[model samples]
Target: MLDRSRTREGHSPAEALRDTVEFARRAEALGYHRFWVSEHHGVPGVAGSAPTVLAAAVAAATSRIRVGTGGVMLPNHRPLVVAEQFGVLESLFPGRIDMGLGRSVGFTGPVRRALGHDKDDADRFEGQLAELLGYFTGANEVPGLPAEGLRVPAFVLATGAGAGIAARHGLPLVIGAVRGEEPMLRAVRDYRAEFRPSPLAAEPYVVVSLSVAVAATAEEAWRLLVPEAWAMAHSRTRGVFPPLRPAAEVLALPMTARERSLFEQSLRGHLFGTPAEIAESLDALVARTGADEVLVTTSTHDRAALLDSYRLLADAAGGR
Candidate 1:
């Protein structure tokens, strides 16, 4: 399960962080394989700006569930700093820590500047990734900082050119399922075809991340997804990603025709339905994409509904 620590309507960012930790504990108890947090800089709706720090908190809170970044945007920080941070995490949690890296710069130009990342830094992802791996494997060394000699499992947050990067580095690819099926499957195929056996990963492994919402009825599940879909639409149209609002309020808001179109389109990629329905859809997705693992990432306005979605999803995935 992945949590961006979304600050929904009627909730503070602090509350979102606390809720995320609580959610992680519950997910662990419910038998989730891993619980991941995301990194979002200068996004008011998201409170997970420092995934490594938050991961430490999560690791301390839960015993069984593997804790890691959904990913840390590698372009935002120095490769040495990232390695050290994850090295510390791996030392503390031992075999339970993960380091999923991404090439994305901040969402906006100002945010990018604030993070001291240029547009060109994104292009340096492959190099950054190599440097990160070198720290753990003792292949490449920094003069001042010694290699940690810790082997932290690494995953690339795959998208566009990222699949090729992951394949080249021999790291597992983690792609979002929000992209349509054909494109996603094609990306997976390309990743596997191009994969090289490095010291980190000897074979290709793909993890598909799906935005999920399960309920007693499909209608209720769709309701739970509305807040996130609408927020995504608003971000596209207004250039500002605001905190998620109540679904009823979102429905009542007067939106431009284009915004309404975008809202509906955004809803298309999600897997929302009753447990049986979601399970069937997810199974088909896994079969089609040949995903080695499935990761669920969901955010909603209502805290109770959000937790319930995880419960239903866990039940649905148990048989898999």
Candidate 2:
């Protein structure tokens, strides 16, 4: 599960962070394999701006579930600093740390300036990623540093040129359920075909990430997606990305034609339905995409229902 630690209406950012730690505990109990937090800067809706720090909190909260970023934007920081941070995390947590990474710079111009990076910085992701990974193998000038020789596993979040980069590096690729399945499928096939064996992985590995909601009825499941759908629409229509609102409140909102269009479009890639329905759909999706793992990133105003959805999904998958 990849949680942004989304702050909902009438909720504090501190509460959102605490909720994420609590969610990790619940996910551990429910037998989920991995629990990942996300990174977002200057977004009023998201509280997980510092993924490594939040990852530490989540890691300390859960004993078994693998904790990591879903991921850290490589463009925003130097590779050495990131390696040092993850090195500290791996040193503390040992085998349970993952280093999921992305190449996004920032959300807007102000954010980019604040982070001391521009969009062009994202183009250097491949080199930065290599340098970051090299530290674990004592590739730096000074050997046996904090990050050197630590075996923290890394996964790449497939953004612009991420598929090809992951292929060359032989790291696990984490991709979204794209607008059309064909484009995503082609990328996966290309990644597998071009895969180069390395210490990280011998064969191509793909993790498909998406929003999933399970409930007794399809309408309820769809309703659980409303908050995020509305946030999507709002972000596109307005420059600001606000916190999540209740499903009922969002449903009653007055939206323009464009807002409605984007809202519906954002809802296309998500999977929400009854347990049996979701199970069959997910199975078919995995078969189609050849996914080694499925990472659910569902968020909703109702925490109880969100957990229930995960519980039903686990039961449907026959639990751990």
> How many backbone clashes can be found in candidate 2?
0
For model 2, residues 24-126, the per-residue Cα lDDT tens digits are 9999998889999989999999999999999999999889899999999998988889999999999999999999999997899999999998999999999
lDDT digits (tens) for residues 1-320 of candidate 1: 89999998777899999999999999998999999999999998999999999999999999988999989999898888898898888878888998889888899999988988878899999998888887776667473143367778999998789999999989999998546777888889999999999878899999998888999999999999899999899899999898999999999999899999999998898889999999999899888888889988888998899899899999998869
Worst 10 residues of 2 by lDDT: 138-147
RMSD of each predicted structure = 1.3, 1.2
| Best lDDT among the predictions, by candidate number | 2
Q: What TM value does model 2 have?
A: 0.98
TM-score of each: 0.97, 0.98
The lDDT per prediction is 0.90, 0.90
Global CA lDDT of candidate 1, please? 0.90
